[model samples]
Target: MTDEASAPGKSTAPGKSTAPQASDQYVQSLARGLSVIRAFDAANPVMTLSEVAARTDLTRATARRFLHTLVELGYVRTDGKSFVLTAKVLQLGYSYLSALSLPQLAQPHLEDLSLALGESTSAAVLDGTDIFYVARVATRRIMTIGITVGTRFPAYATSMGRVLLAGLPQPRLEEYLAAAELHAITPRTVATRGELLAVLDKVRAQGWCLLDQELEVGLMSIAAPVWNHNAGDVVAAVNVSLQAQSVAAQADPAAYLESVRRHVVETARAISQDVSAKHGDA
Candidate 1:
């Protein structure tokens, strides 16, 4: 379920080093073991020992030791030559998801919206330059990529991402824009900083965002922010996704847009209210 190809290795940069300042404070071995766990993703679900070593930037002997340790711990399994993560690995992600009430609170709302509109609905929170989907209800497949809990996509190209990004303070937004890698994933993706800033401004003013074919060829989505009632901050975003071709099939595109936008906004507001009621500062 991990989206990361490999959890990043410690950087050589002075301020970014993961080395313990004091010998007793940090365990480099533990960090390397975690890196091995993060190396498996959808693209590389199963890997040879050498592949794991290459991905984690560890020596063959070191990587093999960690893999054997994980196998003994029941987090990984192997068939002589290739190793793959087992179902037990899900426990790690489940622990985090279980601690947060947001996913549970938003599930019913997402289900209802998906059932009512025949579209996919998802909720996500920003993580660095990516948006990780925590909860989702899929009515049908709309993209080549399959999205499930823990799935992630670039924030700059998604409707939900833009809504969350728009909620950031001006200085933070500028900092993100300056540092983010805005590669053009699709022909319509907003890759330039100027264009992204303009889009963020529109999202800020409208309190919602609509992205069309920016992430993939035919996918369209509308999203609204889920506000934290106690703190008055955007904590997550909710979105409804449909195929671009479906838009024209409706009796009126304008009416369809209005209805979808209204429902999505209402769904996000309901989730926010639920979170506020259940957990004061969540």
Candidate 2:
């Protein structure tokens, strides 16, 4: 199953540029090469030459050349018939993750929160229309898909995504609302711009978000923002997710969830303080 909350659609070939056709800076070949690499995913980790060509919307000759180039570069491997990405592919994102201090700083806090709450804790940063997971401490699998450091979910459907959205400046937030393709991941997802704007206003004022089964049928999550003191803006979000049944079983479900929200907010604040101390607000 796809880790993303949204339903699958046609994969856009990276080579299909959204940039101006006359733009001198565009690199079509690089985009096509990346498209070939992206053609492999959780559901189709190993694919034949024709399969890769069809997925990437590239000619068989072009796909074969890109695949062989990637294989030679150690980013892909083939066993005569099917090709799969190699561990070396992760190196592509290593530099960015290494330079970002949020994951390193948030890991300990997430681990502690997960230990205390007996739930999964995660940290994510807004990446385009999605929240890209940077660190995770899972006590048990609450989602159908196994969540790992690189997993991504629609920002509109997830607690961490809403927290990040709430942190955005008004202009950017409006731009996002106008451009976002709002659709229902679940019945509870806020799929309308007007509803989402109201929710974001509340989340911004309250400095936290509690999303109940919006991203998935049985999952519930609470999130708070992690700030960049120097920029005075949110750089990431931290959250804890548990099965809805667990909260329902509590003697006082509202109070139990409130306590969890408090813990999540405290952890987020602590991480923000640490970030401020290390990066300095001057």
Candidate 3:
């Protein structure tokens, strides 16, 4: 029942952000209520009132009131001693997914690509420093964490994220580099901003990205940008995920790279074409 926030892959705890100036139109209470919802994530899906208070930096009394209010609104549900989000929470994300035709159009293409490559495939859009999965088709599980519609991952550590990041303008890209936390998620992760920028340059020029075990220890992925023909901009990215061990069995691993890239790029282009046609821009 709780609504997801604008920033994906992040649990916004109270005191972690500066309070906006109170005004006639600005509602501090609503912001606080949302923060309480944002505090729940894949890692902490259920929590007690005290845990919610600590996570959000709100007083226990304030947290209790928000939880009760959310319960009354059918966003939060209580199970004896703990609180958890309900299916109604998906409505918040569904609104965005419904408004944009990308996810719906990409679904069939993603399924075909996954079957063709014999791997999992997905499409996502950039949301702040994160990329949120909008459509996905899995042939097999490759990551420890489960990914589904509405799942989010850091853009810096993902192939799809890099494709989206590469689409950013110069000023926006620089701003992102300056403000983003470049923490290493895996040993193969690009550790420095300079290295990431260098990689992004290649992505910008090549119009594709092949990430080898960067986001996780054994996962490899290739992604290509989904262009908006009407707007002349990158709107989203599509990717195919592979397991390193499975790829190692290939007769020519080096040659396999080009094959994967071609498949991903073609799939992305097909989706872009669909998007353009649907908007009467083609």
Q: Which residue pairs clash in candidate 3? A: 1-75, 1-86, 14-56
The pairs that clash in candidate 2 are none
lDDT of 3 by residue, 13-108 (tens): 322444556889998788889888877766578899989999888899999999999999999999858999888888877878899999999999
Off by over 4 Å in 1: 1-26
Please give, for residues 216-248, the per-residue lDDT of candidate 1 as tens digits.
Answer: 777789999999878888899999887788897
TM-score for all predictions?
Answer: 0.85, 0.89, 0.89
Of the candidates numbered 1 and 3, which has the greater TM-score value? 3
For candidate 1, the TM-score is 0.85
Considering TM-score, which of the candidate structures 1 and 2 is the better prediction for this target?
A: 2
Candidate 2 lDDT over residue span 1-282, tens digit each = 222232232123222323235467888788788888777765467899999999878899999999999999999999988999999989989999999888999999998998888878999999767788999887766676677787667688888989999999989888767656787777887888889989999999999999887787878889999998878999999998877888899999999999999999999999999888878833
For all candidates in order, the CA lDDT equals 0.81, 0.82, 0.81
Error of 3 at 215 (Å): 1.6
Worst lDDT window (10 residues) for model 3? 1-10
Model 2 residue 61 CA deviation in Å: 3.5
Model 3 residue runs over 4 Å out of place are 1-24
